[model samples]
Target: MDDSNENVLTGSASQSLLIKPDISTPLIDSKRIDLQTLINKFHNQLGDKNWLKYQSIFSSFILGKLSRNEFENEITKIINSNLLINFHNQFILSNLANSVRINPSPNSHISGFGFNNNNLFNMNNSNKKKKNLNNYKFNNQYEVLKTNIMSLPVKERRRIKNIKRDSGKSNLLSANSSLYITNPQNNKSSSQPREVITGNAVTWSQDIMTGFQTLLASESYELPDKDTLNYRMTGIMREHGLFGSLDENSINVMSMAIESHLKTIIEETIDLVRYRKSKYDEN
Candidate 1:
């Protein structure tokens, strides 16, 4: 959103307006936004006239300090005493109801917030059945993480290099021409050749596998299929510049390391299932 440091390009007689750069820009400041941060943003945007009344209760519910039943009871009292007459108030009430309806079944309807047989939430969640917290299923989590990593958009670093190179060439053009252009950001003093530094896949693989192990250990889940996991892992390894460019030898090294760790995880998960069953028999 900050455009103050962008480079500008101009043509001779047509140098009337500033042209925006073609470089990719991030939509948000960071990848993650916490609940409190979101609440502050909403408060600033929507103001506090009606917000002040329910901010405390809403914050508690959102932060998991208040249970669903308690939140519904508190909100109902507010709705009864202060009727939501306008569309804005009704919309706010509906949103509040929606925030707590995390796992509505297909036939479930939105109630207790003036919504008349609303199946919107139900329809949205119909495809996604509620997952039991204690069910030991590691396959789904692994697949989700794999999908996220694979779907990550690759930034065209080459395009930036080309743009900087072309911008430098403008200085060689005839100054007497009717049109002229220059790039202050790509001036001769700062026009140094950038080195393509590849990241260490061996070290990165260690950390990546460790993190995945931690995730699986903490969660109860079924073990993922080895062949499917191997297939996805192979694709990830073959992915160019993911962990940076690795030579044939280095590629084999990293692949072996990750595969070895994955094998250990599969063994541990089987042991865990056996342990859980033994404990249940004793109980």
Candidate 2:
């Protein structure tokens, strides 16, 4: 240690005081280095020296043309890699980069070229449209015009009032009953503030379906009992020839009721005629 100090003291003061060249600051003059040329130099230098695992940084910093931060990060990765020797031999040469570092202060590093190159051939992919979160698209397709009925005018739907119904069958048979018969073609009193009959129901044949349709049009048919419902339903089913395909017991019951009512009406009509004739004879 004493011998080293004595030799340094004996050295010329001017030589010792000579300022070192700054490798971190590049020359801004016309002799500026090309990025490709710099990378080529690094590649050639590596040919004569031991391969440093991280020396590919030349491609990233020069040929690959990355920004400064990217260059330092890559260099840091090589330095921290699992290798016996981290840096290339040419990198350690005293004249190569000297004591230059990447960052400005002591807390910084030397992973970079440790210097700036004014002329860099950085590959710019920035101009290309970058695929970010916004670049994504949904895979679904959309329809333009709706072909549904809902697009029609609302007023086109005319409301048909349902026939009103009552449970009393006797009430339906009265003169004032909404179910009372009418000859639309004849001058017949409907037992109300009488009005002239319209010719709507005048048809060639007395069709059962025509009667039912007319009845439904004139007034609501009220059901007196569930049996009455079976009566009307079975009647419709019979007219349509579908009655035998369904439950027979209920159909038979309604048929019996209808037959009994018809018989009673016929017998009462006969008794009324005999009584009226006997009264005429007594007079």
Tell me the lDDT of model 2 at 43: 38
Clashes of 2: 0
State which candidate has the highest TM-score: 1
- Residue 164, model 1: lDDT of 44
Regions more than 4 Å wrong, model 1: 1-245
Candidate 2 similarity to native, TM-score: 0.17
- 46-114 per-residue lDDT for model 1 (tens digits): 444334435446445544466766766665544332222232243442333332333333443322222
| Residue pairs that clash (backbone atoms under 3 angstroms), model 2 | none
List the global CA lDDT of all models: 0.35, 0.33
Model 2 weakest lDDT span, ten residues long: 136-145
Alpha carbon lDDT of residue 81, candidate 1?
27
Q: Which runs in model 2 stand beyond 4 Å of their true positions?
A: 1-246
